[model samples]
Target: MMMTGSALTDEAAEAETLVHSTKTDKPRRIAILSYRSTPHVGGQGIYLDYLSRALVERGHDVDIISGPPYPEVDERVKVIEIPSLDLYAQPHNGHFALRPRHFKRGEDLYEYFAHLTGKFAEPLTFGERLKRYFAEQKPQYDVIIDNQTLTPGLLSDALQKTPIIGIIHHPITQDRQLALDAEKSFRKRLLIRRWYGFIAPQIKVACQMPIHITSSGAIKKDIMREFGLKSEQLRVIPLGVAQEDFHPRDDVKREPLQIITTASADVPLKGLIYLLRAVAKLRDDLPDLKLKVIGKLREGATSKELEALSISDMVSFESGLTREELARAFCAASIAVTPSLYEGFGLPCAEAMSCGTPVLTTDGGALPEVVGDAGLVVPKADPEALATALRTFFKQSDELKAELGRRAFERAQLTFNWSRIAPVYETVIEEAIAR
Candidate 1:
């Protein structure tokens, strides 16, 4: 059940009093920094939204400082917007049409030139703006939580006034490598490298941070290796699902032949092309099979793959769904698949399980850690293995399917609930503050 504004504030106050009575320090005032935080854009936005709310529920004062395409944060949590060029949101080729007046500010000129050269400069530019913001306003916080905004400007003197802890979902080095591996052309590969040029600064900044947090042991290892940081410098704090929103609904009847996946279709790391291929292979045997994708059906590799496989009619796409809508989508599906090449933590896998849906996910990065033994596991980028897994599920009796779904829900309740995760985050924040 959703709590009203007064009730939420009262609960936070009580929790704060309880924490203050036990500890010397008052309730921590935290500032979470995100370069870009729009929920539908990527998992980072969702992470900020849920984490900020969860922290507030645990009696901490949380504020998200973000760039455009801002997150839909909880009402109780505050947001501080640090405006950017928002080049991606431009109607058409806005980067190429910049006027002479735009060159007045160094950041504006840098952002435009970077976009024109096919490079992502948001992280660097956001850090610069944030540094300036800190210098001008001198905001006070017990700790600053850097949400993967590993840029040199964050290391600037103006922003180093408070103790900072960084959360690295996963090293972007993996993303760059995967994209390069997927592309065959030399020019395209070069462009991909240039776009991911921020990784070098990210690595440098990450190594300099006193502490870094990740969602799973797998990601912890990746960050350590990628940034050349010691094991002790990194900590793993698993993410939580919103049980109130994603809980199972007995009233929602599941579609026996329906499969669902949440992914950004164009990104190679999401491995949507393989899932489509698997669906194409299964359609002959299970002609009624339908795949529902919770992402944009952009005219890219995914669309081309669907057209090439002649299975376009069997698939449907959805974007910008609210949590309630997404939960209903999970409950109505017979099974959910996460075919990512890698993930720091698979939020959709946990959400699907929370909705009492059996999940089939690749053994990518931290997916196995999230799925545990509650769902099916397959090798990454292997459409044949995914197809075989789907066929096996199709052969199962309804009774067995329902039983597996029950197990998935039970596992999520025990392991993925926010009630269980918030305390761990609080401990991490305390550690950062103490250091």
Candidate 2:
């Protein structure tokens, strides 16, 4: 009771050290690998950013090794940059242009040539660099989590020091099928097949992996079926949203007639074409309706569809928004829609729900699992069904919309928050280390 200030300070320091030591005793060293991890580019980057941060929060050291379009990771998470040709960043025809120095390295030469021939070779090239880095640096990690890269170089003798778990966010087979279905011309089909040639290597590496992690049961099933993996070899861990960052802001007023969707415009699997058709069908009845798309607007089938419907004026496109901007966009919208042909995990659906926005999504891949009963579900690739669902919502009263929003928010908080999901990842890593 009569202890001096110095004595009290010493006691507090000792208690802190004890707690830190206890947590550190079984703390793991984790390496998360990604070929292209630009956060705004796609879901894979977002997964890497959030998962690494969550793991670090749980008292593990996480290092992210990524190629160009590097991820914006937390300061606590170290990022190991792996340089590549990064042809995608080149302007105009620069992607096809090559320098004399590129011919020096086999990996760089392969990447440039692959791009010249309309093939995607980042995974292969990144893996080559990763294996080289491991051979030279010999970095120590308890487990290496490959974020859907599935490159053959990962299996090289240089990287056999640690257990590697591959994450297959659904199979690239689905994407190939959708892309092929979208095109009818013989030349186009041939080019599509050429671009997706990487799938073969992916399948080979996935089959070789001892353990695979997926985001949902749907994705696990696809991986098992496509890669011929056994049930026990796969682990399902659902992804999490930044609940605190995505939550509804009371100060932001929702636009009663505004609708938002986060689908890549040119990607056939994203089903943006169907969504555009649905919006066109609703244009007659809801004259004030406006749709905002969070993706790049490129010349493709999406553009043709918009032009054919003559509803281009009613839709606006915004790309590369910061996380805060995206959250605010969700909160300000009356409805958030996800009209994908398939998804390994419908991240935008969960994010919109976390922002207290009512959702309408197609029953594609894991959309039903992620949205549950909190959002409306329609058939995949059916524009009429999506239109009907949106019409029903437009006819509903504000009270019903508000109730749906509340349920969506609650569902997201209970199921998709990082705090709830990080422990599952921790357990998986521990099991890998144990093996």
Candidate 3:
């Protein structure tokens, strides 16, 4: 059941139940800090938004502290907005600096330059805001957990001592390595690496924290190896999917010979290029096959690859969709693919499965761990293997279609509902406070 109180209380209770609970006091206060929330941009934010709301449902108080691309939260949960220059707010065309976001000492300019230089600045800026917030008014919250804003400033600043915990979604190091491998030019690789350099502070800070948490052990392993951290330092907690929102839709028509994918269409780390090539190869065998992408199309290497492959005509791009529209897309899809080079948690794969759509995922980081036996698995950056899998799905359509969908639906129900997840988070909050 969905928690009715707040993220802190709900997850705290869930955590307690997972192990063994001896405490009688219910957790009252919770703080979840993140750089950006989703629907404003990506899945991380959506994860925070829904999970927080679910927590609130379970009778806990939740406050989300976030930077640019703020979260869309329920009225019950308090949102502490930490506004940045937000250069990447929307359509950041050439004339951004003079837009006048007023600066005490030109924090906006520094951020804009950082973006231009491919250096991520949100963690640093958010750290400054958080430090200021704590300095101005310190509240006696039961627990304070950061949602993947692993910057050193949060740990180093005076804000470090307040029953703090870190919620690392997953380390971004795997994304960096995949990107560097995908880069066509040495200069491109260098720029990508530079952008990822922002994670250094996160690595440094994880060492000192009493509680460090992640969504999956797959992710925990990755973070430990990449961040030079120890496995014992982290607590693994898997997040749940929103079954009601993601489940099968009988109203929507499932297009035959159609496939769907949800991710940034432009990012190289997502392996959109690999998917596109696979689609092209499969289209030759299944001549009427088509692909629909649910992410914004960008002018990047992946997009360029799509154009070069001559399969641009076969693919449909749609962005800026509400959750309902996205669900409709999932319902209409015959098969869903997650061709990422790496992932900490593959939300889309689970979401699609919840919608009763069969999934095919690449062995990119934690994707296989997430997909398990419910979906087909393939190698990363391999068009031939993907094409073969797609062809098999179509060739055995009648025999495997509903069977695959049924298995997927069952898996999603057992593992992904938000009601089930929110309480677990509540438990973690209590555990953190106890620590």
Candidate 4:
């Protein structure tokens, strides 16, 4: 039988796609670097775990080279431990961790003094350890990717000979500015500047890299502007979601007038204070309104704000929840909220959407990019706006809420799942190796 012209064209396109997919599916040895990778502490751990797992699933050999508080990754991916002083893990903050033994080594002395002076020296210290480790181990990798370390050691000629990419989630400059703006004391402001002194080295390292990966375009632009790099230097590969681990639980009953959010840190950047105030404002009219924050409400400005607002009784906080437990928290809530002042890729927002929860998020950084049209968007740090959005959401009937959840889940399947995102990463890795 003679094939029609359209049928021939379709066959040709299918063949081209198959060829491209097969080329990308070819395995390569990959090394992922992370200074610290504790999931609840920050997104670095999550990124390393998910990306390594996704890449390995695509038939790549993946290993994580990390410092203290190492990442918990998939069984197939190996984790190479590079120990630091683990200063943060010590009592009295990092002060008590310092000892006469630290004085014996130049790098240890630098780390100890820097921490005592309120400067974050982990990245540099970790880099020194990484350099020494590489010198001794001499492991081979086709491409190496650093997760937000941006250390001087990455620029070492030994490692630079390999195809290396740096992942800058977002500019720490933004975080520094937000912290400065939040603090009123000059001494504390000075300390904030001191803590972020690593940004200078980070910028230097980022600018020298051959290629970089940022989670969102918003972050890519920020990196270019902050690190003095051109747009071509950066690749925008949005983060992935573990959809299987965070799917809808229809058997879990949703709580009435209850809201859930994940704010791992009680910082100004998280915008939890605004959400607290909004909850305070809405609780009178909706007396049953309750909030469950998936983070510790430590004694700090946020806790003090809760006391001032007198809404402490209306709010509850939890931490260290497993992924399945977190999904259940999302399922049981009437809606999920992420009121961040800024985000690199808004992984929590994507997680909520994957769980088929209707989300109400602030248009901060890449959050709007993550939520898109599936969830409600409010301006960041505006209690009035947040409260209004909450009120509007609560006013909706159960059918509308379920419909929103369905849309969120559908959107997650189309855009946020790892099955689609992992290949983009492979393409970038291949390009770096070829270059």
Best by lDDT: 1
Tens digits of per-residue lDDT for model 2 on 318-430? 99898999999999999999999999988988999999999998877878777776888888889998888888898899999999899889888977878767776766676
Clash pairs (backbone) in predicted model 1: none
Task: Sort all candidates by lDDT, best to worst.
Answer: 1, 2, 4, 3
What do the candidate models score in CA lDDT, each in turn?
0.85, 0.85, 0.74, 0.84
Local lDDT at 123 for model 4: 95
TM-score top scorer: 4
Worst 10 residues of 4 by lDDT: 1-10
Question: Candidate 3: TM-score?
Answer: 0.90
Per residue, candidate 1 scores C-alpha lDDT tens digits across 1-435 of 111011112222222233322232467899999989988888889889889988888788999999998989899999999989888888685655687887888998999999999999999999889989999999999999999998787798887878899999998899999999999999999999999999999899988998887877777778888889888787677778888999988789999999999985489999999999999999889999999999999988998999999998899999989899999999999999999999888899999999999988887788877776678888899999899999989899999888888888988897777776677667667778888
The residue-by-residue lDDT of candidate 3 on 1-435, one tens digit each, is: 101111222322233356333332574677888877755466787788777887777777899888767788789988888777777654653235545545553556666777878888778777876777777777556777787787665765467666787877777777777677767898978898889878777778777776787766567777888887776677766667776678788799888988999875467668887889888887668888889998877877767778898888899888888778888898998999988877777788888988999888887766766666677888877877888888878888565887888877887786567666665666667766677
Error of 4 at 418 (Å): 0.7
**Least well predicted 10-residue stretch by lDDT in candidate 2:** 1-10
Model 1 C-alpha lDDT versus the unseen true structure: 0.85
Tell me the deviation in Å of residue 347 in model 2.
0.6
TM-score of each: 0.93, 0.93, 0.90, 0.94
Residue-by-residue lDDT tens digits, candidate 4, 49-96: 889998899899999999879888899999999988888898888787
Ranking by TM-score: 4, 1, 2, 3
Candidate 3 clash total?
26
